[model samples]
Target: MRMAYLILAHDNRAQLDLLIERLLGPGGEDFAVIHADRASPLWPELRASLPEAAGRVHLVADPVAVRWGHSSLVEAIAKLVREAVRLGSEGAHLISGADWPVTPREAIAQTMREGLCHIEVRPGHMEERMQTFRLDTRWLRLDPARDRRAYAATWELRRLARWVDAARNRLGLPRSRPYGLWAYGSGWWSLPADVLAMLDKEMPRLLTSGRLRGTVCSDEHVVPTLVAHAFPERIAAHRRYVDFPAGASSPRMLTAADLPAIASSGAWFARKVDVTHEPDFLTLPDFHPAPMAHPASMRGKLPVSGQA
Candidate 1:
């Protein structure tokens, strides 16, 4: 079975090259790589580093200039997913520039053979809150100026927007969800081809909708939410390992000290790894070998918590 790897990358070209090599080295001919580089000027340099065998690796044209906690991240993912679907991928794995696959090729094949989709969907009322709130007002062209006067004006506009939303909520006005679908979970996911096709079909409408255009971090809510709406049973806690130390807003950059736990976690991948800081971690003897057991065996065990 073929799998499509959709990567949203902005930096760390060397690490990304190594990851592509490993994924295509053994038992990987059927695998395809679709990438979106956040409009970095160095993308051509990185693309040149990819091996010829990486013929299946395709970099997206017209990549968005992504900002953290903005809708542009979601737009990049949408572009990658659209390209992967167009390439006729049977399954798709969404990951970041800093992410590396921990599972060996054999284990990845086994997980696909079992027909499991790796995604985390936490159950709660937060989905409702996400749909109801309007925190992404920056897209309204209210912050055109970078000066203090502009900043003050933008702040006031945001305050007014929030107040309007609050009053609308109290009055029970017609607030719509993202493409009329409930939002859910961290945006990272490993989804089946069918679900990806569904996403491709719906993305245009969602992207054009005013609700998503003005929402903050819609990437965290869009994919898993739509996937859950389509097939709730396929939603399992995500298998990517991410360490969020207490009080930290983002996942800690993984280091050599994290190798043992990462290996034992039975996860297929881990994120936010910087090879420059810890060069030895990736070269460790046990880092790339296929686990003896199937990854599906560890399903439903890991917690579903992490920033996108």
Candidate 2:
């Protein structure tokens, strides 16, 4: 399978470079498209040159400044999907800058060809995320921990938007949810070519129709909602491995202690890895990069590319 690895990176250049290098290891078949946040310092270096790996890698043009839990994250993924489709790959895998591969390349491809959209589904539709108005970005610097008072104006704007939404609801106006989409899932996942094409068609409309304008964590909601409603049959297990402990908003940073579970789990990749936590977790003798066994082709739009 010719696969497109769509990466959304903001910081951690060394880790990002290592992830790409390993991705292009011995098999050297798959290609990647990197979208560096415009506000990130790594943008200039990544755009100037990629790692010395022997695979096709491209930088996204005019990347949007991505803020956590904001609409820009959704916009960035949509842009990546459009670029991947243009490359004519059979499938696209959406990954974070902090993720690293745990399984061989072939296993990853096989998982993608299993005729299921691999997204980590959250229980229930989580209707409240959209019923209330949310600020696209709640703060300018986005570090309320440092100075919440600095964003007094932003808080006022959010308050005003909430009042407007409340008034509309009181007047019996419809909620601003787009396409009546209510499903939710994890941000990191993979999709077959047809779904990629479907997202390409629908994402622009969903993002710009003014429905998802105040959508919180649209990255986790918009695409998953579309898949749940439009292609419910294709929905299956998520391939990426990350643990979200009950009531935790973020995944725990993986350590060497988790290697056994990572290898045992059916997941092909693990996320939120940092070299500092486990200096030699993915070392040479323990883990090696090579070609994986290629499986039968993905169902539709399987244009061959150079993947590992």
Candidate 3:
């Protein structure tokens, strides 16, 4: 099957190039569809550097300005999925520029199919994220640690929003749950070809419903939820090793020091890696040739009680 590596990438040109190179096979049989942030200064440079021969790499036109924990992320992924399908890819492995392959290409290749989605499915709806309107106030978003003035302002706004949401909850006010019976997890997955089409079809509904307008990190929810809604039996575990500390908001960035756990995790991919912080990581012995590992072995690699 011809799979598309549907990557949501921005900045880190060297890091992104390395990710693409590692994912590519010698024959260039599979292709990639990259959606870079329009706001990034390196957008043009990154686009110019990629080898676009034979339509192997399709950089998105009219890119979306993505933000952390925002609906824009959902929009961006939907666009990428539509483009991947249009390019005639049977399925897609949705990932980020910061992720690396955990298993050999051949091993991972065996999982690609038209209707089976490989993803981690958290059992219940992320009620807090969807129940409250996590509105993205279009004001100056500054680093709270560095800019006290902006931080104080945003903090007050956040507090007000939180109070409102709490009052509504206490009052039993109605709320919107766009993707019904939401299934959420880490914002990464491998989607089947049929699932890609479903996601593409569902985008208009999501955008029009306005349910995800203020949902925190809707990317982690929408895809898995919709896939389960349409093809529940085709769902599979998301075999990606992400070292999240218990109760941590984000995964720890991977370095060469974590190579042992990463290699033994029996995962198809690993995430939150950055070559900028540890330049030597890229030069470390490649970890992709590992033997097929059982999904249960991933738990041992975790530093805390969280998703793998």
Per TM-score, the best of the predicted structures is: 2
Candidate 2, residue 266: Cα displacement in angstroms equals 1.3
TM-score, one value per model? 0.81, 0.85, 0.82
The candidate with the higher lDDT, 2 or 3, is: 2
Give the per-residue Cα lDDT of candidate 1 at 27.
40
Query: Which lDDT values do the candidates have, in the order given?
Result: 0.67, 0.75, 0.73
Clashes of 3: 2
Off by over 4 Å in 1: 32-34, 44-51, 132-154, 178-181, 284-308
Candidate ranking under TM-score, highest first, comes to 2, 3, 1
Q: For candidate 3, write residues 1-308 as lDDT tens digits.
A: 77789888877776676566566634547888889987886578766777433557788886888877778888898889889878888778889888877676666667674356888777475756766765444443567779878768877777888888888888888576555667777878888777888888997578777777667777788877788778788888788989888998789898778888877777778888865555444554443454323324433432342321
Per-residue lDDT over 1-308 for candidate 2, one digit per residue giving the tens place of the 0 to 100 score: 88888999988776776677667655545788999999998888887878666648888998998887778888899999999999887888899888887777776787788768888665346766766676635453555776677666678878888888889888999575555557778878889999999999999888787776666776888888888877888888887779888898889888888888887887767888865335444451212344322222211212223311
**Model 1's TM-score against the true structure:** 0.81
Better of 1 and 2 by TM-score: 2
Q: Which number leads on lDDT? A: 2
- After the best TM-score superposition of candidate 2, give how far the Cα of residue 192 lies from its true spot, in angstroms: 0.6
When summed lDDT is taken over every stretch of 10 residues in candidate 3, the lowest stretch is: 299-308
Give me the runs in candidate 2 sitting further than 4 Å from their true place: 136-145, 151-155, 245-247, 284-308
Which one wins by lDDT: 1 or 3? 3
